[model samples]
Target: MIADEIREQIDAIGIERGRPLLISDADEVLFAFMAGLESYLQGEGLSFDFSSFAITGNVKDADGMALDREAVRSHLGVFFERHTEALDPVEHAAETLAELSKEAQIIVLSNIPLAQRGARARALARHGMDYPLIANEGAKGPAVRLLHDRAAAPAVFIDDIPHNHASVRDHAEDVHRLHFVADTRLARLIPQAEHCHARADTWLEARPIIERHLFGG
Candidate 1:
């Protein structure tokens, strides 16, 4: 769902015609979210199993027992507070986006607490991806739809989550969906989402696909 602050950010932007739009996720798509989160979890005597795409069921303690959602949620809160500003960008993510942004309206639409929005934005900017970062909560369809409505040209949505790909399909079916997972471990665990037009595990592979779709050869 789109938050009020996110709506304000959208209302402030203008998408020029013929310019393609790239709406992307921050964690695991542009930034190394799982990598950072795993290290942070380790600091707290917890570790991620990477058994599945979802987080709540995969984080385990030193004893190898998965923690409940509530506990994991609390740990996540701390993790973001400690590491949001320090997450390493996925290799080639920034340079690719920087190149694309010259010809497209690129937006980082991430599902994160509003408190971490500024930090994430700054982190991306430091790596040369200084686009508008919108903070979202659940099913990113509505927010993607609003952003899509503002564009009169080709649009592409990228994320590591399958449900998000499906959500975008439900709301903005015309937008090209690209499923991207930066971490090889998580990438291996996730199957190709049916709604995604294509999948890329690295930005090197992603750039050409995005380029071909956003601007016809």
Candidate 2:
């Protein structure tokens, strides 16, 4: 759900009434998160085993021992803290959003820690995505719902996580959801989320769908 302060942030965004809305996830969808994490893990003498969609269970030490959830979380914390401002963007993600922003009020609804929100925004701005960002903590359903309600327009939600799609569907039944995994390697391992309207592996394939959904053909 959303905390009071986070709710305030979402409300503070200047969403034009009747303008289309695009709510996007930062990592994996906009930034090359998994790739950056894998490289960081290598530096820490650990490796990311892309066996499944789970990050915690897939990380292994040099001895090939799986890291516990807490350890994995710690690594992720350090990874984001140290590398948030430097991670590369997914191909064409910024360009596509910029094009979409001509008609849509865009907001990055990433699951990053609130403390790193400014760093993430600065990094995104560096890549030409200067939209307002909401650093969310838990399920994105309620936040997506709030954004949708405020915009009062056809909204599109792009994310790589299936659970977030389900959460948005549950909280905001009308928001169009597209499951987008920009990393080809990660896309090969994940199935299309049932709750999502479509699965787009790259921004190339996703842009048209969002345009068609928000602006119509």
Candidate 3:
């Protein structure tokens, strides 16, 4: 399932020689995204409509008028531009990821835009995390596959979205998939995913599973 250009990209990164641990998702996985977004919306007298999983159609003003797609995009661009460097890490994420790095080559493969890459890296570094960060633009499946093919087996995949978990599961069944739900309220809104090997509410809950899988019980 890996393509030639992607293979070249992975080869360039040199994932083949080490045990890779892909700790990912910048928003809800590493930082408190839902709260930040809700705070942003409230300032605009807007709130999540709770009608769907996506943000574009779900964000609505107090009068219940949802922002148009372009407006939503514009708002997001502004939001990330200002707050990318200020986002707080998910409680316990830095320490957990730090501990895991002792045994595996940890890299963050995120869907964050290229424009925000440096700020995101700075944000993570400020939180005591200093790992390689890959800012991707499309469905994460292709990147995950590229990593899987070029790296050693038994890779670990962590993301806040179920679809992402499914994407990795479909692409590389051997890769360990963890569903990390950060915002308790929105977490409750998302149903349990059968494809995800584990569902984690906090980095603490995910720590042992990762350690056990990597270090062996």
Q: Which candidate is the best by TM-score?
A: 2
In model 1, the Cα lDDT at residue 110 comes to: 90
Write one digit per residue (lDDT tens) for candidate 2, span 1-217: 5799888897788778889999999999999998999899999999988889879789999899999999998988999899999999999998988888888889999999888898999999999999999999888999999899888999999889999999999999999999998878888899999899998988889988999999996
Question: Using lDDT as the measure, what is the rank order of every candidate, best first?
Answer: 2, 1, 3
Model 1 alpha-carbon drift over 4 Å, by segment:
1-3
Arrange candidates, best TM-score first.
2, 1, 3
Per-model TM-score on C-alpha atoms: 0.95, 0.98, 0.88
lDDT of 1 by residue, 1-217 (tens): 5678778877766656567899999999889998999889888888899788789989998889999999999998998987999999899988888888878889899999999888998998898888888888899999999888878688989999999999999999999999998899988987888899999999999999998888974
lDDT per model vs. reference: 0.88, 0.91, 0.77
Please give, for residues 1-217, the per-residue lDDT of candidate 3 as tens digits: 5445444545656664557556567788888987887777787677887666678888887788888999898888888887788777889988888777877777787777678888998988899988777776655677787777766655778888888878877777788888888888778778766788888888888888777666664
RMSD (CA, angstroms), candidate 2: 0.9
Model 2 CA deviation exceeding 4 Å by range: none
Clashing residue pairs, candidate 3? none
For candidate 2, the per-residue lDDT at 35 reads 90
How high a TM-score does candidate 1 get? 0.95
Model 2 lDDT on a 0 to 1 scale: 0.91
